[model samples]
Target chain A: MAKPLILVSNDDGITAPGIRTLVEVAKKIGEVVVVAPDGPQSGMGHAITIGNTLRLDRSIAFDDLDIVAYECSGTPADCVKLAKHHVLKDRKPDLVVSGINHGSNSSISVLYSGTMSAAIEAAIEGLPSIGFSLCDYGHEADFSHTREFVEQIIRQALQHRIPENTSLNVNIPKKSSEPIKGIKICRQAHAKWQEEFDERLDPRNRKYYWMTGNFVNFDKGEDTDEWALVNNYVSIVPCQYDMTAHHAIAMLNEGWEF
Target chain B: MAKPLILVSNDDGITAPGIRTLVEVAKKIGEVVVVAPDGPQSGMGHAITIGNTLRLDRSIAFDDLDIVAYECSGTPADCVKLAKHHVLKDRKPDLVVSGINHGSNSSISVLYSGTMSAAIEAAIEGLPSIGFSLCDYGHEADFSHTREFVEQIIRQALQHRIPENTSLNVNIPKKSSEPIKGIKICRQAHAKWQEEFDERLDPRNRKYYWMTGNFVNFDKGEDTDEWALVNNYVSIVPCQYDMTAHHAIAMLNEGWEF
Candidate 1:
């Protein structure tokens, strides 16, 4: 049988340590093709390059490892679209893996995450996909500790089909002194960013604002991603791109008159 | 009793005619404040400006009408965040309304929609929000016919609470000789874009690609937004920011092992 083709991408640029690590793991699973953003695009969400043109350039990120890679001049979602429709146009990959991101996309953050956006784009294309992230945000955050679990999760996803029209959001807790706990299947927690803008003066002494925010979790349910992270467990959330609030349809049908 | 306060925004920039029509209609309901992008920000999903400095300037778009408005140098989601945190600092608005967009945001288009992203941002912040779009992509498309339905939906939303953590994705069909049928409360259809990148040579003779796609609907269900739009009825889909596929949790727990 031919090896399963795996398309790997990330928001942290093609050469980031995170994707390098993700590539290392993905190679063990199948034939790996890396196509990712040329620069960091952390909070890009599901943005696409519509008004602007896109550039897809060959990169030597995995030259030593003898893998095919490309650096795309667009957002994460753009990267996936370009890969599927241009670079890998004739052949669809068996699976798509995004990230091993520097920071978490555990709950409400998922809505603003470029990492998860890539996975969601693949899911929208009817491909099985997974986005992996670390809870650490530092530039040189330790990723070695996540290797075992990351491999395990990817293996399972490739072996068993993810639920139809769904992608997996896997967030690993930062390396800790205690041995890592097992994985937990969880839901996205009810949480949000309490936004704050730091009002400041630029070099010209003109007013400009820098966005900052605090993450506040309102859901106390144990089956949530937040709970799993706090308990040092790897959290896997099956995410779907269908934004429809199915439960609310009945409410609107009954109460709203037009 | 005080009239409900409505925070209005759009992805087509502050001066666009679509928003003017929206502001004209929104004012009939309550006190209005507008904060939107200074330039077009189409396809900018749930992105927030983090690494970049943001500029917010007072705009005279609604000056004659006596409504407070500001133009922000950011994405649509950034407009909502800036409004909630900086512009409208002390007082929270009763509701958030985005668009009256120049283009459609039905079915799978919602994922890449800056218009819907603003409403989803408001939903994440626990506000009752609605994103209104006309199924016409032209800049001068007639939105006059949509006003009555828009007013009715907003009135219903303000009178009765939206389901918790949910926003409304409302799309009105373009003007026709036949009047629009009543609004239909619908779900996001199972659909996706069949992407095609129009590769071309730049002035520098470098190969560049323009991203384009055709919308393909796999779902033929009558209860979907696509069906409602084709029938000339306004489609109202309740959208949620939580990406969790709750039904798949049990399946993941049983099928995949750590």
Candidate 2:
């Protein structure tokens, strides 16, 4: 049988250590193709390049590993679109995977995650996808401990396939002394970033603000992604792109005069 | 009783006619304040600026009406953050509204909508928020017909309150011969943009691509937002920030081997 074609991408750019680790693992299981941003695109949410021109350049970043790759001058979501519709137009990828991101995208952070945006973009295109992230935020975050679990999750995803019209948001705990307990199927925790702007003056003496925030978790349920990561386990939250609050429809219909 | 403080914003910059219409309606109901992007930020979904500085300047755009307004160098979500954290720190807004956007943001377009992002950002901050959009995509779209409906929706939202943790995504039909029948509480229709990249060459002879697409609606459901808009009714879909597919969680737990 032909190897399953896997398309790999990330928001940390094509040269990030995280994508390299993902590529290393994916190549062992299937045919891998990489299409990612040329530079870091953290906090780029589901942004797409509109009213702007995009450049897609072939890259030699994966030459040593003998893998095909391209660096795109666009957001993570844009890279996925270019990949599916242009680069891989003739052949459909068996699976699309994004990230092994250098940080967490567990709860409300998902709303601002470029890593998951790539995965969600693929999900919107009717492809089975997963976005992986480590809870570590350091520039040189350790991805060694995550390799085995990453492979396991990918294999399981290929075998069972993700639930229809959904993508998996898999967040692994950072390297720790204790072994990971197991994987937990969890819901997104009710959480948010309490933003605090750091007011500063530039050389021109004009005021500018730096966005800083504190993640505040309000959900205490053990079934939440936050709880799973806190307990040293891999958390998988199946996510759908449909933003509609179906339960609220009846409420509005009953109460709203219009 | 004191007047309700209504916070207004948009992705079409501080000076767009769409926002002017919104301000005209909102000020009639309550005290109004505006914080929006300095330039067009359409299609910038949930994005926020990081690794960069933001500029927030007081604007005289609403000076004639004596309304407080500011323009920020950031995305729609960032505008809302600045409004909540810095601009309006001492006082909490009774309501938050974003856009009478120049274009449509129905169905899957919501995933790429900057207009909805501001409203969703406010929802995450625990505020009653609504994003209004006119179906017309013209530079000078006719918002005349939408005035009454926009006002009605805002009044109803202020009176009845939106569902907890949800923001309203309301799309008004473009002005036509026949009047709008009524408003419908609807769900987002299953749809997607089939991207067609228009390859071009820059002045330097470098290949560039323009992202353009045709909106395709696959859902034939009468209860969907697309159906309502097509049938000349204002469509309102309550949108939530949570992307988790709860039903798929149990399925993944039972079917996949962790």
Candidate 3:
């Protein structure tokens, strides 16, 4: 049988250590094709470059490795779109993998994550997809410890594909010396960021403001990603793109007159 | 009664004719406070500015019109966050109105729309919100016939707040001489873009690609937002932010191995 075609991409630039690490893990799964943002699209969410144009070029990042890779000059969503409709137009990928991102996309942050957006775009295209993000946000954050967990999840997902209506959001906790705790199946916790802007001026006497925010985790339950990360365990939350709150649908129907 | 405080924003930059019209209409309904992007953020989805700082400056766009406006250095989602948490820190807005957008965000496009993102952000913040867009993408697109529709919907939404867990995604047909048909409340039609990357060689002899895609509507039901917009009527699709596909949860519970 032909090797399962794995379409890989990320919010970080193609050459970013995160995607480079992702490429390494994906190669073991199947024939890996890397098409990711040419630059970081960290908080890009589901943004597409409609008002502007996108550029794509094959990357040398995978030259030494045995994988095909391309870098796209657009948002994370655009990378998936370009990959499916242009680069891999004639052939459908068996599975799509996004990220191994430098930062976490757990809970409310999921709504603004480019890493998750790439996975959502692929899911919309009917490809089984997953987005992986580590708790660390530093550019040089350590992703070495995440290999075993990443491989286990990827191998399991490839073996038993996730349901059609769902996409996986896997967030690994920062490392500890002890053996990493096993994965926990969880739901997205109700959480949000409390933001504040710091006003400042440039040397040219021009005013500029820097956005700063505090991540306030209001959900105290042990089931949340926040708790799992704090407790030094990997969290696996199945997510979806359909924003329709069907449970609220019936309640909304009764409240408003159409 | 004292005037209602209406917060206005758009994905199109502040100078766009669409937003000017929106400001004009909103002023009649209440005190308008405009917090919009300094540049166009068309497909920004629900993105927020986390890594970078956001800047906001008071604007003189509608100085004589009595609309207090600010040009923001962030995505639509950031604009709403700034407005709610900073700009109007004291008084809660009676209505949060986003976009007299230059283009439609009818179907799956809603998930990638900066216009709708602002509205949904307000919805998540427990405020009444509505996003309005024209089917035309042209800069010079006429909105003369849309005044009454905009006023009607805004009035209805304000008088009777939208259903809980719901915000309105309203799309108006382009300028027409014929009498306008009434509004239809509907669901987002399932749709996606088929991307094409236009590769080119720059002056430096480097290959570049421009992303382009034709909008594809696969939904056939007459009860969809796509159908309503196509039939020359205003479409009001109640959008929500909760992305959990709850129906799948039941099935997952029945079939999954922990």
Candidate 4:
């Protein structure tokens, strides 16, 4: 049987250590094809390159490794679209894996994460996908410990197909003395980034604001992604593109007169 | 009793007709404050400006009007954040309304919509919010017909109060001979953009691609946003920022090995 074709992508550029690690793990599972942004796109969310042209350049950075790679001059979501519609046109990928990101995309951060956006784009295109992120944000953050769990999850996904129109957001806790706890299937925590802009004056004497924020978890539920990460467990939250709050529909119908 | 305070914002920049219309409607309901992108930010879904400086310039465009407005050099989500954290600091808005957008954000388009992003941002901040869009995509699209319906929905939202953490994604059909047949509360239609990149050569002799797509609806259900719009009924989908596929969690837990 032919090897399963896997498309790998990330928010932290094509040359980042995170994507390189993800590619290595993906190569072991299938014929890996890497299509990612040319630069870091950490907080890009689901942005696509509209009113702008896109450039898809074949990069040789992954030449030493046994994988086909391309660097795209667009967001993480754009790379996935370009790969599916242009690069891998004739063949459909069996699964799409994104990240092994430099920072955590757990809880509400998923809404602003480029890593998960790439994975969600693939899922929107009817392909099974997963996005992985580490709790560490440093550029040289160690990712060796996440290899086993990443491989296992991908293997399990392939063996037992992921649900339709859904993508998994897997966030691993940073390495600690206590051996990393097992993976936990969880829901997204009700959390948010409390904004605190650092107001500054530029050289031109113009007032500019640099956004800084604190991640505040409001939910105390044990089955949440935040709880899993805090307990040193890998959290896997199954995310869907359907933004409809189905439960609220009934309430609105009852309360709203118009 | 004091008038309700309403925050108005959009993706199509501050000067666009869509936002101007939205502002007009909002003014009738409350003491209005507008903070929106300085330039068109279409397709910027849930994106926030990070690793960069943001500029919020007080605009005099709406000086003759009763509302105070500012044009910020950021995305739709950024506008709402700036309004909530910086501009409107000490006071909490009674409601947040985004758009009268120049295009439809029904179905899957919601994922790529900056208009909806502003509303979703407000929802994330625990505010009752609604994003309004017209099915027309032209810059000079006629939004006059939607004015009555838009005002009605906003009044209803304020009176009834939307469910917690839930925002309404309301899309009105373009002007027709027949009046709109009331509002339909529906779920998001399962639809997607079938991409077709128009490949072309740049002046620098480099190959560039223009991303374009066709909207394809896979859902046949009548209780969907697409169906309501097609029938000339205003569609109001209760949108939430929680992307968790709660139903799929049990399946993954049963099938996958940790």
The candidate scoring highest on DockQ is 2
Fraction of native contacts, model 3: 0.50
> Which residue pairs come into collision in candidate 3?
A211-B53
**Comparing 2 and 4 by lDDT, which wins?**
2
Candidate 4 lDDT by residue in tens digits, A96-188: 999989999998999999999999999999999999999999877999999999999999999999999999999999977789879999999
Worst 10 residues of 4 chain B by lDDT: B58-67
CA error at residue B4 for candidate 1, angstroms: 1.5
Q: Which regions of candidate 2 deviate over 4 angstroms?
A: none
Write down the worst ten-residue block by lDDT for model 3 chain A.
A244-253
Q: Write the per-residue lDDT of candidate 3 for residues A108-129, one digit (tens) a residue.
A: 7788889989988998888888
For A1-258, candidate 1 gives per-residue lDDT tens digits of: 888899999998997899999999889879999999999998999998889999998999999889999999999999999989899999999999999899999999998999999999999988899999999999979999988987898888878889989999999999989887899999999988898999999899878999998999999999999999999999999999988999999998888666
Steric clashes per prediction: 0, 0, 1, 0
CA-lDDT, candidates in order: 0.92, 0.95, 0.83, 0.93
lDDT of 4 by residue, B44-149 (tens): 9889999889999899868889579999999999999999999999999999999979999999989899999999999998888999999999876889999999
The interface RMSD value for candidate 4 stands at 0.8
Q: What's the CA RMSD for each of the models? A: 0.9, 0.8, 2.3, 0.9
Give me the displacement of residue B247 in model 4, in angstroms.
Answer: 0.9
Q: For candidate 3, what is the TM-score?
A: 0.93
Candidate 4 error regions (>4 Å)? none
